[model samples]
Target: MIAVLTSGVALGVHVPGLLLASRLRERDVPVRVEVLERLLPPDRLAAVSASRDVFHRDFRVARVGQRIASDPVAAISADVQDELVRHWEECGVHTVVVFSGFWLSLVRRFMERTGRAPRVIVCHVDSVASPSFRKAGPALPGTEEIWLASRAGTALPWTIPVTREPPIQWDRREPRLLVHGGGWGMGTYRDRAADLVDAGHDIDLVVHAVEETGPAPGRTRHFVLNPAWHPWLDDGYPPLGHLLPGRSPADVSYTRGRTHHSSFDLARAVRAMVSKPGGGTLLDSLWSATPLVLLEPSGEHEGHNAQLWCDLGFGVRYEDWRSDAFSPRLLEKMHRALLSAAEGPRDLAAALSGSEVSLCSE
Candidate 1:
């Protein structure tokens, strides 16, 4: 059995773990996914829950909130930890994939208690050590890693596949952009949307809170992850829906996706993604063959992600796009570059399963 451990703190970390679990199950691997916050003591969980509101109100607060979640010594009861260990033992879990660094101490405890060393794969979703993995050196002893964005020590570099569908060709998509601040809705994207609209770009914008900002004619359409849904509260893929601003969520039309995530449903049809360079956004851009109009990154890791996208020609910085007058030709060139990069994406599931078959569309 393969245990995929995740945290509810951010979608960039959580979603990749879900995608990996999905792919492994496809290969008939017995998989179990555990949300780390679910194991926290009620008081600790409440504190984690309370952080979201403050974090949403300020982008800088995310770094602090994330630090709270990543504390290796965060309070999980001894009984709760043992219960998790026994569950994994009974599940016959032999390989554990770590998406958040906070889970490393748990994995270590499982080994010490059960005296079983499951193969540990620390999956890094960002181009550099993400918040969850910061200073993980002492925590991650003798673990193999899969770096989805960067080339790093003893790590197999990989690109996460977000969908089973092959990418839509460059000219096949409507000339619209999908813009959002990623899963948390914690970036400068809401502010950037005005600039795009002023520049005459048609876009689909995602807002973090339930703002009653209706769309502007000929410039924008609004979409959002169901405002009522929170990662800690719901284990399911985020309920994505077309936001009918000034109306309740019940009035919004939620998507039923073919895959675990619905964001890819919109992503594949758009010509480009305009947002912070979250690792998950990069994954979506790769699989959908959509270019990116990278915006102000939420943190240093995302800053590296934006730079990598620029270096690889998969995207351009938002300021650079502004300087270039938001050229459609630049996006087209990026789409072409993405299409080429999409061709040989390594399937992390297949690699882990020792299979020659690839999940990437042929």
Candidate 2:
């Protein structure tokens, strides 16, 4: 049996966990899943239920310690080591998959002691779009194999094979737009929605903000304010506090809030995805071949991602958060992205709409 372990969060890594479970199950491979405890509220759990039934129904669910869940990496690696040992022994699993932050000394020691530990694989979901090597070295020598949601120049050099397949999603329809700021809800991306609404862009708006509560802007047709969506769709917006302001509402459809639960195909069919860079949402948008408009108030990661697409002739980028820049810039680039998207997967748009996954070989 192959055991998959991860933190039960709404983030992108969960996608691959679910996909791995589904992939193994299809092959009749016995599989189980254990998550580092991060007790989710009932509503968030419901959203998770809607988006992913794999971890819930297909695989076994186990939890690590409360301290590890609350203060990972900093919570004394030895404690984590002890818990993993206990968990591993109880499961009597052969292969194990781990998805979490950087390696801890405890983890390394555990691997050493366990000797020939499960055929471990680490999957990276971060798509910050920057080429910085600071965050790329950890999972390299520590695991037997590594997978990524999108390919990067760094991956090949580092000997990490990347894959294009996203986690198995239950919903298969194209959505008008999708908006969520991540776990903290608008932690830093809240202003982007307000800016768009202030501009009168009469589009659907969905907000999963801090306190899971926020004022719904004018353009939102369907609102999911202060709510959680499964698979943590908050990467759809900028990180935190980087919203653009000033433009009048242009004619655009907008929807905000978590769609990880709904299976709306915005990533697959969005005219353009606007957000700060450096997360799975960016990769999802690219895979959908959806054009991209990267807005960054600070981190150049989003800009770098936009540059990557721009280099591929797929999309455009905007550094400032002014309404003037976004209004005209988005209008032009969104059009270009849509046009380019029609051409093929070589660009962002085509990847989103045209790409297909072959389950048997997946």
- In model 1, the worst 10-residue window by lDDT is 353-362
Regions more than 4 Å wrong, model 2:
8-10, 37-71, 74-80, 90-92, 103-106, 127-177, 209-218, 225-266, 297-306, 318-362
Give the least accurate 10-residue stretch of model 2, judged by summed lDDT.
58-67
On a 0 to 1 TM-score scale, where does candidate 2 land against the true structure?
Answer: 0.55
- Would you list the C-alpha lDDT of every candidate in the order shown? 0.77, 0.42
TM-score per candidate, chains pooled: 0.91, 0.55
- Please, what are the lDDT tens digits per residue for candidate 2 over residues 172-211? 3233344444322322344555666675544444444232
C-alpha lDDT of residue 189 in model 2 = 42
lDDT of 2 at 127: 36
Clashing pairs in 1: none
- lDDT by residue (155-180, candidate 1, tens digit) is 22576667777888766788888888
